[model samples]
Target: MPEVVFPLDSTRSFTDQSLVGHNRWHPDIPAQVHVRPGDSFRVHAREWFDGAIRNDDSADDIRDAPLNSVHVLSGPIAVEGARPGDLLIVDILDVGPIPQEDSGPLAGQGWGYTGIFATQNGGGFLTEQFPDAYKVVWDFSGQVATSRHVPHVSFPGLVHPGLMGTAPSADLLSRWNAREGALIATDPDRVPPLALPPQPDSAILGTLSGSEFDRVAAEAARTAPPRENGGNQDIKNLSKGTRVFYPVFVDGANLSLGDLHFSQGDGEITFCGAIEMGGFIDLHVDLIRGGMDTYGVAENAIFMPGTTDPRFEQWLAFSGTSVTLDGEQRYLDSHLSYQRACLHAIDYLTTFGWTPEQAYMILGAAPIEGRLSGVVDIPNSCATVYLPTSIFDVDIRPSAAGPVRIDPGQGVPRSSF
Candidate 1:
């Protein structure tokens, strides 16, 4: 099948009914177009937050933008032959920032930004330590990204779509909402509050005609976390040459893509991410009949770019155990523990001839990986930060210090771990 280009209208491609918002995914949203199995296409996606941000943006910019408007997605491109219980295989052919001539205000051309969301807003991995919102404007050129915000640090761009998924069936949507609603109710006051149901006003951002399902689906579609439908999993290595298999729960397997990033670390350590940029993705869509039954993936699975062989050189490792330095529990959450570990790694690198700000940039920009080393130990989950030593020119050692307390409920500890 020949490749098809989307949004067909160039003017509305960047900002129009095609862009989906309201943190919810609904099957009712009309498909922008339909393509047959084995067909290929190029999708243009806007930056997260619908380009409300700019390279010159500040914390105030992030503060003012509607927190609910995120992960601006591109489609419900119905795959002709796809059906529920099958696997929608998306082969990433190419990904890059939309060039300046074609891109609107959000174009990628020696410009982009990475950010740390405000803790009060309830997002980001390391929210406790970096409470205030921060922005780092980056310049991209010659396939590399550099920033005055993070002087002396630069790296090649490794572009990828941050959120990719198919529309969930009405039943799957109900189950996801019920489960997440209950989880958030347990801690309503948590930073980046849990219960982020779709708001009726969400339709204002796009063309959804305020259908009841649209509102509920939008509420359920918060793009902050990755779900079985594959919303916002920030896996950095899922670029070209990788094939992502998402379980189809609805007819046509309506697929969408957005939240494009020029680069990101393994965990997207910062709440926002590396060099968020508006871009185009060339992809091939295929289907596996009865793939869900064959693979047993309740959600989605990805075949990495390369075989199981390692990609980076020996990494400088740092471990973060669940118990904070003050001997308080961190709720035994692997994600929170991993954030704690990454913060510790950032803190340790401060001694290696870099400031805290530079360390934060390195963590996000470099090809670092965060791994869950162990989570079975009762009351203590451990995660590790693996920094590819080759990315840096100077050698550094493990800090004499240890993991610090991150859970604000536990109160700030006196000593740095």
Candidate 2:
């Protein structure tokens, strides 16, 4: 098919009657454009927080962005010849930060920002330890990310698109909201389990073709965590050359994406991530008839490059067990135990004179990886955090930090974002 280009112009209007500024992703949102199978496309997306931020901007600038408008995604590009039960293959080609024309000395190409969420908002992997909001502007030249706000450490870049997904059918959207709402109701502290709950987007509502399907779609769809529709699954392995398989639900598989990152480690410990920036993306999209049937799963699956790229370095690993060093079961849930492990890694890094904020930025900005070492252990499970040794010039290892503490209550509460 032909190559489609979704321009970066923030002022261009769509046939759907929505202005260019209407960039949020929701099933109710109408498709701005369409492409045929085997078609290649280029799209321009804004940073997760949009362009309100600058290199010199502070934590306040980070906090000022509304949670509802978290990821300013580009298009719900409808793919022709794609239908329900089919698989949409998105081949990532290239990703880079866009140059800023009005930028100051520190702003422009190779420059992007990272942020920690505010405690009052109550979200993130390390919410309790790094309660206060923080911001760090990183320089991405020389293929390494270095931040003055977070000094004494730098790492190479691994550019990737943080969000990629297809639009859900109206029925699927309702089920998602209902299931998520029920999960939130079960939390005693009411910590939000869902990444995003449905919120009204007047921009999307205005663009609906006034069809009954569009109205229902509007009330149920949300862009947050990864779902069958495939939204924000911050998997670091999905760099250039990666093949992403998204299950199709809607007629055209309305694929939309945004939330670009210069580099990001696993877990995205903080709510925000590495060097968020606006950039253009090139993708080759194709359809596989009955591929979903052969896979036997109705979700997103990623196929990694056959060979590890030279950019990835050897990792120094840190391990944490669900049971204490003394062997007492702390949490029955393996996922919770794994979280404690990550926190342990964070605390240990603080011994190197890095504040929690700095450490948080390090974990997010660098290509530090997280994995569950094992989950089969009945009472005690284990998790490991691996940091690429090449990221630092010095021999950075965990030293005698104070005894690490795990707080089960320290997590994001359930709320609409």
- Top-lDDT candidate index: 1
The worst-scoring run of ten residues by lDDT in candidate 1 lies at 408-417
- Tens-digit lDDT string for candidate 2 (142-181): 5577777766577777778888888888777778878877
Pairs with backbone N, CA or C atoms under 3 Å apart (clashes), candidate 1: 23-221, 23-222, 24-218, 24-221, 110-140, 122-191, 122-192, 197-219, 198-219, 402-417
lDDT against true structure, model 1: 0.69
Query: Tens digits of per-residue lDDT for model 1 on 201-310?
Result: 54323345646555554555565678888888877777877888888989999888888778788877776757787778888889999999887976666555623223
In order, the Cα lDDT scores of the candidates are 0.69, 0.67
Q: In model 2, what lDDT does residue 399 have? A: 47
TM-score of 1: 0.85
TM-score of each: 0.85, 0.84
Looking at model 2, residue 319 earns an lDDT score of 74
Point out where model 2 deviates above 4 Å.
1-4, 10-26, 99-108, 187-195, 201-206, 209-218, 305-313, 323-328, 397-417
